[model samples]
Target: MGKHRAYKFRLYPNKEQEMLINKTIGSSRFVFNYFLSLWKEEYKKTGKGLTYNKCATMIPALKKSNEYSWLKEVDSIALQSSVKNLEDSFNRFFKKQNKAPRFKSKKNPNQSYTTKNVSNSIQIQGNRIKLPKLKMAKFANSRDINGSILRATISRKASGKYFVSLLVEEHIQELDKSNNSVGIDLGIKDFAILDDGTVYNNNRYTTKMAKQLAREQRKLSRRYEQAKKDGKKLEDAKNYQKQKIKVARLHEKVANQREDFLNKVSTIIVKNHDVICIEDLNTKGMLRNHNLAKSISDVSWSMFVDKLQYKADWYGKQIVKIDRWYPSSQICSSCGVNSGKKTLDIRNWTCECGVEHDRDINASKNIKNEGLRQIQSYDKIG
Candidate 1:
C-alpha cells in the first residue's frame, strides 16, 4: 500500500526571508478570515457553504480590489491554500468530525501557511529549501527527504522557532510477520504495565517543569500589569513580550520532553510486539475528574495510543482495542472469575482460586486474553 508521511525540519531564515515569511503568514490569515466571513454570509442566503473552488475563484478579484491589493504581495498559492483549509474545516464540521470553523486570530502566537509544489517551486538543496517568495532558506537537513513532495507547511511556534513540514508520498516495506504479542495497561502511576509484569514509569514532564513555568508566568503577568498601568498595550510592552517568550519557551521544553518520552516508548512497544492490546479509554470523560486531571494529562496516554496505532499500521502489526467497559481490573486473570468491584485504593487482591493478582498486571493479562479471543473470533468468521 502507498503511504503518506511528513518530514519536518527546523528552518533558519535570513532577515529578508523572515520578512517575506511573516508577510505570507499574515496574507494567508487574512485570506482565510476574509473568505470565512463571505462563506458564512453565502451559507445564510443559500443554505450551503462555499466550496474550495468557489473560494479560490474569489482570490483574483480580492487581489484586484483596493483594500486587498496587498494580498498580491505574498505567494498566490499560499492564499489559495488558506481558502482550501477553511473549506476543509467547514467540511469536517458538517461531517461531525470536528467543531465549526472559527475565525483565525492575529493574536495567536502560532501561525502557519501551506503551499503546494508547482513546477518545482518547492525543492530541497544541499542544506536549504527553496519556497516561492522566500527563495532559499537554510534548514537543518538532518535526514534526506526520500519521497515525492506533495506540499509544504511553514509554521512559527510560540517559542519563535520556525519549522517546515513536507508532506510526501512514499512506498514502505512492511515488517516481517512475528508471533510476539503483548497487552498493556495505561495509568498515571505507571505509564504502562505489561502483561509480563514489566512497568514503564510515567515521567510527569509537566509536573517537573511546573515550578519554573509558574515563575515565568507570574513575571509575565506582572509585566502586563505594569504596561497596562502605564497606558500601553500589552503587545507594545518590551518587558511583557520578553517574559511571554520565556514562558512560551518553558512550555515548549515540557512539550518536547513529553513527546520524546512518548515516541521512545511507543516505538519500542510497536517494534517488539506483533499483536498489541490496549483499552479504549474515554479520555475526555476521565479528564472531568478535577483531582486526577493534571496527573492524567501529564501521562499523555492518548498520544501514546495514537503513536502505537500509526506505528502498528506502518510495521504490519495489529492493535486490539478492548472495550472500555471491560472489568479487567476486577476479573481474575487465572480463573476467569469476576471478583466484586474494587476501588482505586486497592492495589492487590487474592482471588478465591488462590491466585494473587496485582491490579494492573491482572488487567493487562485479561486485556491480552480478551483481545486474542476477539481476533480468533474474527478469523473464524472470515
Candidate 2:
C-alpha cells in the first residue's frame, strides 16, 4: 500500500502574491469562524447544530450578500474546505475525541489555508509551484518530491516567512531489517539514554536563547505601549510590528533548532534499530507537576516520540511501548530484584546483587528485557 507523505518547502511570494494569499487565508478564517458562530447560536436556540451541507449551501448566498461580497475574491474551494474542517471539528467534539470548536483568531502568529488540487492547479516546475489565485510562486525546491499531489497548504510563520506543504500519495519502499533491537529512556537532564549506554544531552534550545528573546520581547512591549498611547492600530504601528517580528524570529530560531535536533536523533535511532522499546509515558499527565512543566515542554518528549514512531513505521521497524506504570527504574536489571523506589536525585545506586548501575542505563536495560519477554509471551500465545 502507498503511504501518504508531506513535503514542505520555503516559499518566496512576491508582494502582490502575498497580498492575495493573505486575503485568501483571511477569507477562509472568516468563513470558519462565521459558520462556528452560526453553529453555536443554532445549538443554543434549538439544541441542534448546523450540518456541513447546510453551512456549505449557505456559502453562495453569503458571497452574494453585500456585507461578505469580498469573499468572492478568494477561491471558493478554500472557503468550502473551511466548512468541511468545521464539520470535522464538530464530529470530533461530539465523539469526545477533541474539544469544542472555537473561533479562529486573526492575531495568531501562524496563518494557513488548505487548497485542493483540482485539474492539476498545483504543480511544481523548476523551483516554482503553481497555486490557485497566487499563481506561480518560487519555493526552495530542495528535495525531489516523488508522488501524485493531493493538496497544498500555504502557511505564514511568526517570523514573517511563508511556506507551502504538499500532501501527496506515494509508494514508499520499506527498509531492510537489521534484526537489531534497543531500548531508550527519556529524561530532562539527558534527552535519551539507550541500553548501550549512549547518552543524548538535552540541548535546551529555549534556554540557549532565553536572554536574547527576553531582551527583544522587552523592546516589543515598549513599542506596543507607544503604539497604544499614540492611538494607532497595532497592525499599523511600524515600530511595534518591527519589534514584534524580531521577537518572533528568535522564537522561530529556537523552534527550528529543536526540530532539527529531534529529527537527527530520531532518524539515527530508527535507522540503527529494528525493534525499539520505550516507556509508554503519559506526558500530558506528567505535565501536571508545575515544578517540571516548563522543563518538560522544552524537552518536547511527545514530539520526539511521534517522530520516532512515524519514522519506525516508514522503515518497517517495530516500536514496543511498555506500560507507563511499569517499574523500569525500580527493578534492578542485573538480578531482577525490585529495589522498591528511588528518588530523582539518586542517579547512581548499588543493587543488593553486587551491581552498581547508572539509573537511566539500568532502566533502559530493564525496558529491553521486558519488551523482549512480552514479545516472546505473545508469540507463545499466538
Candidate 3:
C-alpha cells in the first residue's frame, strides 16, 4: 500500500520573491472568489452548480479578459488547484461532512495556494525550492525531503511567516508488534488517564497565555478606537496593524505549544501500546455546556484522538473506540456489575462487589477489558 505524508518547512523569500509570493496568494484568492461568484449565479439561474472541469475551463477565458489579465501572472496550476479545492468543498458539503463553501477573503489571516508536480516542475535543490513563478525560494530545510513530491502548498500565517508543505508519496515500514495494550480516558482536569493508573495532566497552554493575550487584545482594541477617532480606517492604521500582528503571534504561540504537547503524548502512547482504546466522545455536544466549554476547548481532546489515530495507522497499531454511552465510569471493573450512574461530583465510589474505585482509572480499566473482549469476539468469528 502507498503511504502519503506531508513535510512542512519555513520559507525565507527575498524582497522580489516576497512580492511574487504575495501576488500569487492574491491571485489564487481572486480566482477562488471569482469562480465562487459564477457558481452561485449559475446555480441561481439554472439550479445547477459548477463542476471542477467547467470552472477550470473558464480560467483561460478569464485570463484573456483585460480586467482579469493579472491572473496570468501567477502560476496557472495554482489557480486550477484553487478551483479543485472549491469542488472538494462542495463535495464535502453535499456529503454533510462540512458546511457549504464560503467566499475567500483577502483580509483572512490564513492564506494558501497549492500547485502540483508535473514532470518535476516543483523540486527541492539544497536549501531552496524551485516553484513555478517564485523560483528558488530559500527554506529552512531542517530535514531532507523524502519520497516523490506530489504537490506543494505555500501558505502565509497570521504571524507573517511563510511555510511550504510538501505532500509526498513514500513507503513506511510498520513498527514491530508489541504485547501491551492500553485504554485512555480524556478529561479537562487531566489530559489523559491510562488504564494502568497513569495520568497526564493537561498543559492548558491557552490558559497559561491568556493574560498576555488579553493585554495584547486590549492594545489592539485601543488602537482601533484611536484609528476611528483619527478618521482613518482600521486597516490603514499602522498601530492597529502592528497590534493585530502581536495578538496573532500570541495566539500562534499557544497553538504551537498545544500541538507540540499533543504530538509528544500521542507518540508515547502509540509507541508503547499495540491495542489502544478510547471513548468516541461527542465533542460538539460536549462543547454546548457553556461553563466548561473554554476548559474543554483548551484541552483539545479531539486533536489528541486524531493524532493517536494517524500514528496508530502508521505504526501498525490497533485503535478501538467504545460507544460514548457505555457507562465505563459507572460500571464496576472488578465484577461484571453495572452500578447506577453517579454524578460528576462523586469522584470515588464503593460498589456492591466491595471494590473501591477511582472514577477515571476504573473507567479506563473497563475500557481496556471491553476492547480486549471485542477483539477476542472478532477473532473467534473470523
TM-score (all chains, Cα) for each model: 0.97, 0.97, 0.97
Root-mean-square deviation (CA) per prediction: 1.2, 1.4, 1.3
- Best by the TM-score measure: 1
Q: Candidate 2, which ten residues in sequence have the lowest lDDT sum?
A: 170-179
Give the count of colliding residue pairs in each prediction: 0, 0, 0
- In candidate 3, which residue pairs clash? none
Candidate 2 lDDT tens digits, 1-382:
7788889899999999999889999999999999999999999999999999999999999999999999999988889999999999999999999999999999999999999999999999999999988889999999998888999899999889999999998888888888889989999999999999999999998988889988898899999899999999999999998998888888989888999999999999998999999999999998999999988999999999999998988879989999999999999998999989899999999999999999999999999999999899999999
lDDT of 1 by residue, 129-188 (tens): 999888889999998877789899999988888999999887867787667899999988
lDDT of 1: 0.92
Give the number of the best model, judged by lDDT. Answer: 2
User: How many clashes (backbone atoms < 3 Å, residues ≥3 apart in a chain or on different chains) does model 3 have?
Assistant: 0
TM-score result, candidate 3? 0.97
Give the residue spans of candidate 2 off by over 4 A. none
Positional deviation of 335 in candidate 2, in angstroms?
1.6
